[model samples]
Target: IQLRAMIRWGLETVHRSLAPWCSVDSIARHLVEQTESLLLQLSDVRPLAPNKSALNHLLATAGWLTPPLVDGLQALGWLIDERGLAGTAATDGLAWCLPMHELFERWVEHLVRLWAYPFGGHVRSGRTFETLVPIRWSSAAPKSLKSLVPDVVVELGSQTWVFDAKYKNHFEELDDQAWFELAEEIQSEHRHDMHQALAYAATCPASQIITVLVYPMRLPVWERLTARGRSVTVAEVLGGDRSVQVALAGVPIQLSHPEQTNQIVAAWNPLFSVGQ
Candidate 1:
């Protein structure tokens, strides 16, 4: 009954405390209206704690729909002076702010899974791909080799598509002339990203491997290049189905709106056609 509890909380909190024009009250009102009489049935239910830490943990672990409700509650808590309800007086005790980078990565993983599922591709996240190499000098000691865990890996037949979701906005990074001046120094991490994506392709256990460095960008773009005799490509995708070559590529994923998620899966369908 967490769902009912959430609806009840949002409904009651808005009614009790938030004015019509409060930052969150409008959203809360719309949510209550959408849920209709359902909240009335849960009159006896109590809402979750409005504490920032507790809500952040819940948002991280709860189902997709729950996070927004929890977020609304957080906003309500702050606007209506429920800081006392959080039971914390320290300034640092405020609600946690989830990192944008991690959220973007998760969103990309979701899109990858959605696109891969219908193509008979098994999509996995945080899959470790590793290889073994002998130590430089032999001794009575343990040996270790580094491993690669791409954000999303799609396995179809003997072909594997390795993907790393980078949260950095290449458009923003490259557009500013300041970044170009220190391009090598400021964008060293980008070079590392390219290296890592290619490394995954080279080391993966597949007859044919396609590596992609996926990032979020606001505009349409695509590029193909060869670095040290290896193929590297980049493309942007949004609300339309477009073909992306199934080789080394940097594909920009677009989620301009929540409703566009289905478009994302469709946009990348052409990737499966490649190497066929």
Candidate 2:
């Protein structure tokens, strides 16, 4: 009932506000028309305002039965997060948007963990609250600062590396446009990413600290960059008394062959640890 209502609400909102704009876009028109048709097939399913309590009850009741059910419940939960089409204006006045970074973050963690398995040190993830380092706040500070959490931390002996997965087009942008020629917003955002990565590095108390910003890119691009020794760009970030290397790396997605994956891991051996 709630699912049907959510769908109905979405269709209604789009039809009322977006119909004029969607008419000229072939793909958008098809999706809108398709949703209308599917809603017709689900006529027996009554429309109801999405209820959080009921949805939780349903998920807990059947989520344990099957994997598909769990996925469906998760998708439904994302749809009903406080970011509903029914915000402050009306019951049907917004669009559903989902961020893709969390999935990318998880994939980064998996890849790094898998490749660095031979190093023999524990892996910690920011998602699991395993890499949190509390911050000491001074009195009279309008304190929003709390702690520094790195996306992935690998500690091999006295050497530590913090890898922060950024789902950015920096690889592509840098390829197409010169650094200074890029848009102001892009440069600003990149600076922020760098700042966050530096903060993450502070969480480690190792003699040698390497902080890396890992971005996903096409396998072909990764290969091209590797040929030029630009796949992993590393430079000394801090001088004198402190040793810190800041690196921006391009990591390709998981490939088909085990040997191919191993090849990639071998290339990353220097950054993480010696190969097994």
Best by lDDT: 2
Model 2 agreement with the true structure over 1-276: per-residue lDDT tens digits: 556675565455445443543533344566678767866876776655456676678777863547765554444454555333322234332345546788778767866776668767578899998998899888888788788888999888777889898999887687778999999999999999888887877667887888888888888888777777777777778565657888888877645443465556556766863221
- Which prediction has the highest TM-score against the true structure? 2
Instruction: List the lowest-lDDT window of 10 residues for candidate 2.
Output: 85-94
TM-scores, one per candidate: 0.52, 0.60
Off by over 4 Å in 2: 1-99, 254-259, 273-276
In model 2, the clashing pairs are none
**Which residue pairs show backbone clashes in model 1?**
233-250
- Kindly list the per-residue Cα lDDT of model 1 for residues 47-80, writing each as its tens digit: 7534556656766786764556766656545534
Cα displacement (angstroms), candidate 2, residue 99, comes to 4.3
Off by over 4 Å in 1: 1-94, 127-145, 171-182, 219-256
TM-score quality measure for candidate 2: 0.60
| Candidate 2 accuracy as lDDT | 0.70
